[model samples]
Target: MPIKESRMTQSQNVQLLAVKAQQALMAALRSGQLRDGQFLSMSQLVTMLGLPLSAVREAVKHASSLGLLVTMPKRGIQVMEARPETIRDCLDFRMVLDQEGARRRIANDDLTGLGALRDRHQAFREAALRGETGNTPDGPIEVDLSLHDFLAAGLGNAQLAAAYAANRMRTAIIQNARPFLQDRIISAMEEHLAIMDALERHDADAATGAIRLHYTQTLRWWGVT
Candidate 1:
C-alpha cells in the first residue's frame, strides 16, 4: 500500500512539473523572450524549463494544441502569431457577452463588480501616464483583459468565463499592438473611466451606450471596421 501510494505521489509530481513547464513556456512566449519565428528546440525547452526533454515535449504538444505554439516537422516549435482574425473573433465574442452582462448587471442593480473594474482602469491610466511599458509584469501585453475577465466572473457565467480565459493569448496580441497608438491608449483610458462613472450611477442606458461606443471606437482605431 505504501509503495502504491508513493507511485501515485510520483505521478502527481510529474503532472505538476509538466503544468509548470507549460506555464513557463507560455509566459516566455507572451513576454517576447521567445519570438514568433524562433524555433524552440527540445534542448532549449529542457534547459529553460529545467525539465526533462520528454516533459518539454509533452508541454510543447499541449501548448501547440492551444494555438500558443506550433511544432514544425524537423524544425522544432515556434511561437504562433496571434493573427488578426483570431483577435477579431475574440473581441466579437467579448462584445456580445459583455454587452449582455452589462445589461443584466444594470437590470439587477449589480454594481459591486464595477468598483473593481474602475480600480483596474485607474491603474492602467496611471501606468500609461507614467509611460510604463505596455507589457505585463512578465512581459505579455498588459491590456485591461482583467476588466473583461472580472465582468464575466461577476456575471457568474462559467461558459463565458472559460471562453474569455481561453482567448487570453489572442487578446494579448491586440494589446501588444496597442503601444503603437499612444494617443489611442490615452483616449481609451478616459473612455473606461466614463463607463465606470455611468455604472456607478446605475445608469444602464448610459453604461451600455458608453461600452458600445468604446468598442466601436476601438474597432475604428484598429482599422478593424
Candidate 2:
C-alpha cells in the first residue's frame, strides 16, 4: 500500500477502536460497573473497559467532552456525580428538546408510530398494575424513552439529536446512582399516553403541554426541587 493509504488505514483503525472503547464505557456505566462520582486511574479504566490505553484515552476525551466524565491532574477520571443541580440542568435541557420535538412532530402531521408507542405505554401501564414488572417486552426504561427518542429524532437536526443522545447517557448515569422508582412507572406510562393522545389529535399545544407536565412530574420524582 502507498504510505498515505497505509497512514489512512491506521487512522481509521484507531478511530474504530476508540468508538468501541466509548461504547464499552457507556455499557459499563449502564450496567453499574462504573458508578456516578466514582474515580478510576488510567490503568483502572483500561482494565474496566478492556481496551488499550490509546483507545481508552480517546474514549475519555470523547466522554469528557460530553460532560459525562472529568479528568483531574494526578487524580484520575471522575464520573459526573448526579447531584440535584446536575439532574435539574440535564432535565431542563432535555425538556427544551422534547418540547420542540413535540411541536415539530405535530406540525409535520406525523403520527406514523403513534399506535405502537401508545401500545407500549399501555402495556407497561397494565403490567405495572398487574405487578408484573418483567412482562414488558423491552422493559420500562426502553418504553419510557421511546416517545421522547422518537420526538427528538423527528426534528432531523443532527447536532440536537446527538446532544439528546448524550443527555440520555447522562440520565442513565443518574439512574445508575438513584435507580428509577418502580412506583412511578405507572404514572409515567399515563403521562406518556396523554402526550401520545395529543400527538394523534395533531394538537401541538396539547402535545407540548403534556411533555411539560411529564417533565414536571419527573423532576419531582427525581427529588429535584
Which of the numbered candidates is closest to the native, going by highest lDDT?
2
Each candidate: what lDDT? Answer: 0.68, 0.86
lDDT per residue, candidate 1, 1-225, as tens digits?
699999999999889888888888777765666654466677877898787776688888987776767888887777666455655676777766666777777677777766766776677677667777454343213445555654565566777666666566645545554444445666777777777787678787887788778778777776776
Q: What TM-score does model 2 achieve against the real structure?
A: 0.92
lDDT of 2 by residue, 1-225 (tens): 999999999999998999999999988876678889999899999998888899999999989998999999898999999999999998888888988988888888867888988987898789888888763323777778888898897777999999999999897787677555557889989999999888888888998899889889989998788
TM-score of each: 0.78, 0.92
Clashes of 2: 0
Superposed model 1: Cα runs more than 4 Å off = 35-38, 119-143, 177-181
